[model samples]
Target: MNAPLTSDASPRLEDFPYRISDNVRFADLDPNQHVNNAVYATYFETGRVTLVKDRSHGLMPEGLSWMLVRLDMHFRSELRWPGTIEMGLGLVKFGRTSVTLDQVVFSEDKCVASAQAVTVLIEEATRKPTRLTSEIVRNFQPWRRRGVNVASPKF
Candidate 1:
């Protein structure tokens, strides 16, 4: 199996697409003094958006927009209030018409949660599913899953 891509051409974890460091805010904690479940989702989202924005993938592509098709999460541990957390994101699969985003939330040395999401590309004007362009695929290909080439069309 090919290693996960660190770039469009290389497949290695050392080429990790993006990493973000963030602190748990007072508002992020619930009465139990632990991070809220919804807040975990928000943190994962922030990590993903921050990476794409800094790396040149706008929140919405020109002539195309991505719609969320699915989201899955797993909580491994509880993040107590008062510590900084790191959020890591990677492009796990870049399919023809969709991309899967994988995110992990870490509280210092501990992994608090992990998540995955699938988003479908659609024509901006008509909101219809469209084939993912080569440029788009190329942008993600470097990081494609080792045994999976996600460039297949999906309606």
Candidate 2:
């Protein structure tokens, strides 16, 4: 006789990688009734944290933190005040001590903004670069899109 197996599942986001219920508040608006440029970065950061709450494995370990080495952003459209938006999280590559993340913001069906960030793993104590462990590599493998070949670093 065989016993039935039970399953442990991870939390899934239906629309966005991680949805923030109340992103833009009354105070979040500029005098023009539009969210300011600085606010957009804040919102994106919020989404990133939520996206990795359950499965944002690796990079930051007991003595390490991800340092943002570079950021590339493209403003496709604008987002007004008091509107809800969803931020999508995707991975482009994961190197020895760096990871490239793709974050996109959408309101309704339209893409509002897109940003790319390259983060490097740093030691919390020494504040120097460190190689990402295999555990993180395995977890992020599933999110790597096809044809996005990120080469192994020689450094």
lDDT of 1 by residue, 21-132 (tens): 8888889988888888889888977876665444475434577777777878777788887889877666777666777877677776667787777888888799988777
Lowest lDDT sum, 10 consecutive residues, model 2, at 6-15
**Candidate 1, run of 10 with poorest lDDT:** 7-16
TM-score of each: 0.75, 0.74
**RMSD for each of the candidates:** 6.7, 12.2
Task: Flag regions of model 1 displaced more than 4 Å.
Answer: 1-16, 54-60, 142-155
